[model samples]
Target: MSKIYVLDTNVLLQDPYSIFSFEDNEVVIPAVVLEEVDSKKRYMDEIGRNARHVSRLIDGLRASGKLHEKIPLDNGGTIRIELNHRSFHELQDIFVEKTNDNRILAVAKNLHLEEETKEKGKRVILVSKDALVRVKADAIGLEAEDFLNDRVVEMDSLYTGFLEVYIPLDMLSRFYEKGELFLSDISKLPFYPNQFLIMKDVMGSSASAIGIVDKTKVKVKKMTFNQEHVWGIHPRNVQQTMAIELLLRKDIPLVTLIGKAGTGKTLLALAAGLMQTEDFHEYKKLLVARPIVPVGKDLGFLPGEKQEKLRPWMQPIFDNLEYLFNTKKPGELDAILAGMGSIEVEALTYIRGRSLPKQFIIIDEAQNLTKHEVKTIITRVGEDSKIVLMGDPEQIDHPYLDAYNNGLTYVVEKFKNEVVSGHVKLMKGERSGLARLAADLL
Candidate 1:
């Protein structure tokens, strides 16, 4: 049975090509959705880019046939610009407002009623990204769903970049003796490139070792910083140890760290960047940046010059740096950075359109970025540069991005098999006991 899906403006803005995702179904675009999209097309962000793309896509489709009627899609589905649904009396009695969401709901409700009266009644579904809109549709006896075409994977089943293997004591001994073990020696366990492994004894012994899968072999290795710490911070957990290894390794140019609050993802990245750029002189400079995503409220209307206005947004980065540099008072870290002349902190917005070379770049709070934003950041890395992306996927503030579809997880999944890339999911929080408890229970 063919279903008729009424798309909301957010669905179109989230994915410009979502009209073709429904195979053999009918896609209806309410005129209100187009109006809402038009209102957003003038902005200069990712949302605006998508809005413009959706408009151009619809315009290109007009060449084939009229959108107000029905235009056939290549995937055996049909799309139509639904302009006839101007008002619905049934919705006014329930919603009591003529908002865009209510208007969209009215169109879906009307279509659902009309389909129910047909000899072969077709299903009418409202597709939207907003939870309230979907809930309202359900209240009005209409089926509704979220736009899932862009979702990469579920949260529970997400890749964690590490696995545990219990093997015979002799195998562990051989691994420790030979310094490495091939996958064939370990029962052909599935392993991704640069994935960390905790090899334990299966014979009820207390023997355990940490290893990392680089090529086809797993090499037994310890943490990078033992005698000397990265700045003043030390690895308090195995996950942090693994993160430091990935961060300091010159072979892995791209590294990603996923964790919850207080998991030390950004701290470890910053520490490694400082070590590589300042102490080791492996890179020319240490560049730290993060996306300017608003959490509860936006900061556009603040009063200041650009740098002064960005102070609050970048305060978290400064806090981490202050802790690392042991800056006791305000402006202390600034003087130190000015004296070093090897550190630059900027926003991701202004970093675009520049080729950065010989720099250790760290992009914190990476979960708020989309796949395109991640691509833009990675493409800007010039020769002899390393980029570390750290974020808590569960703490996403972006309206359109989620744990599975955000740029952090996208890059983690995409680069799992590459040699030059490494990923680590920090399972333990080392910030403080209270913070760790809040991260888990709260």
Candidate 2:
């Protein structure tokens, strides 16, 4: 059954090459989509870059045939520019003034009407990223869908990179004595190499655990984590296990974590960084920084000094600091922050000029960053410094970023499987109940 997909402005903006995503489905780009693309072609950010890319793509397609007419694609589908849509017909009933949303809906409505008259009754689906656009699509009698390509992997099934398994009591003894445990020996087990294991005795009476440090060892060595247990939180799942691997791993020079807002990406990295820097003195200092994209554009001038200007944007970081310091008093945390000259929490804007060394660097909210920005940050890591980039791709505030193209994704897709790097996708929401519910429902 062939379907007609209408590419909304946001869909194109979300992914310039989204037209190719439907496989062989016919794709229709309304003339209004081009208008929208033209307007954004001058943008300085990712959205602008994507808009320009769309323009180039449509232009290149013209070489095959006229865009105004249906052009056959090598994939067995056709793409055409929908120029027959009336600009403002019946729009007054829905919107007071001419708006982009209404304009897009108007195109979809006209397309749906045209489809209804066709003998085959083709499906006219409007693809967009804006929630309101999808709502308007439904209201105006057109099928709509959000661009899912940019979405992070499922919250529940996002790759944790490691897993835990429970084995029978006697199996533990045989493994301890033999030293090498074969995969066939644990075929029914949910274990993987480099995966942390908590081999608890199946019987409730015996409360014991052995970590699976090296799965290839074949000899089951008893795992131990008396050190990391000092903190109240333990590696409860595979994601945490991978996280522990990245933190304990001094060899991997780079690590990246992608998850939603409350997935404990930043918290775990920060805690491990503090442990390594303060407790073990492995690194000389801990450096934390994030881009300063104000909720909107930042005001040109500030009423107070540097710290005052940073207060609003840095509040989240401060909240983490306050919790870590266990302080409620005003200025007390700042005093501590100042005391530890080893710790630096500067803005990303200032990092351009320096080469950092022998430090555990953490860049938060990295999904809001671009590939170029990530490259700049990574290049600054000099000598023995290990950098951990963590952020929620779904919760990005940047206008230009989507999950596939954000700095986190760019780094992961580019660096995964490299010897000096490790990547973990945190699936479970370890935050409180309300936060997790909001993440799931909202």
Candidate 3:
């Protein structure tokens, strides 16, 4: 049955193309949503970008026909702007507020009542990304649902990029002897491109090997770089070892590292960037950037120059760099950073319209970015440049993003089958035993 999906402002802000997602259904945009989108269009962030996109999309649709009336979409669905301008007379007694959210709820309630009077089997559902709004809609006896078109995967089923398989000692020995084994000769388990494997010995000899799954073959891998250490940091666990291999690989240009707090995600990425830029000279420079998302509340404004104001937000990156440089004295790290002409540290705000060629780019706290933001970052990568995105999906500070829908997870899931990308989910925390226990238990 074709149902009416009345979208909230947050839905459109999250995804401008959401109107085309409901196949063969009627998509209704409350007039209030447009007002909210217009208010956000002035900012120069991801939300502002999406708001502008939505306005442009709606304007483009207006050329096809009057938006107040039904407009045919490229998909089988129909989209229309609801200009009912519903008053909160009925909801005023309970909601008791003239806020935009209340106005949106009034629109949904009016549509729900109108649909209930019809004879056809039509349903009116209020779609939003706000939890409180959905709860209020349900309290008012209206059907409410989340806009979940962008969730890449369920949290429990997210790809770990690695698996364990038991191979016989003879097969393992043959793998070691030949340095590679065809996938057809192994068990009938399927593997995505670049999927790591911990091959345990089935003969109970405590012998094990680590290898990456191939489309046609599997090659044994050793932790030579992890053992030797890169920029004074060694892989503390198997996942970290796997991460370094993916990071240092010249062929794989895109790498993603995900884990909880204290998992050494940022530290390892910094170490790899330093090794490739300073030691190996594989890249011309190293660029480290991250989204400047506040944890809870904004600090308003700080009085300083550009670098002074950004120091608080970029301090985490500097901490890792200082550790890598073994700098403890004040201004010592700043001197080293100034002396190193090949290193660049800046906010993601300044990355647009710049071409980064032959650079090792590391984006920390990438989970705070939207999929479109991540796309912009990836599309800016020039030839012969490597980009590493590291973040903990569970620790996202972005209001609209969650573990499944964040940009980091989106890239990890989308690029799992691609040959140029690799991912690793660090399981154990190497920061400290206390920190590891806190991450696991708390």
Best by TM-score: 1
Clashing pairs in 3: none
Q: What is the TM-score of each candidate against the true structure?
A: 0.97, 0.75, 0.95
lDDT by residue for model 1 (1-442), tens: 8999999999988889898899999999999999999999999999999999999999999988999999999999999999886667888778987999999999999889889899998999999999999999889899999999898886588788898888899988887787677766765767888888898999879998888886654543443444456777788888988888888889889999999999998888888899888889999999989898888977566787987777888889889889999889879988898899998888999988999999999999999999889999999999999999989989999999888889998898888888899888999888899999999998
The lDDT per prediction is 0.88, 0.76, 0.88
Clashing pairs in 1: none
Displacement of the residue 305 alpha carbon in candidate 2, Å: 6.1
- Ranking the candidates on TM-score from highest down gives 1, 3, 2
Q: Worst lDDT window (10 residues) for model 1? A: 219-228
- Cα displacement (angstroms), candidate 3, residue 33, comes to 1.2
Per-residue lDDT for 142 in model 1? Answer: 92
Residues 165-190, model 2: lDDT tens digits: 56677777776777545545655554
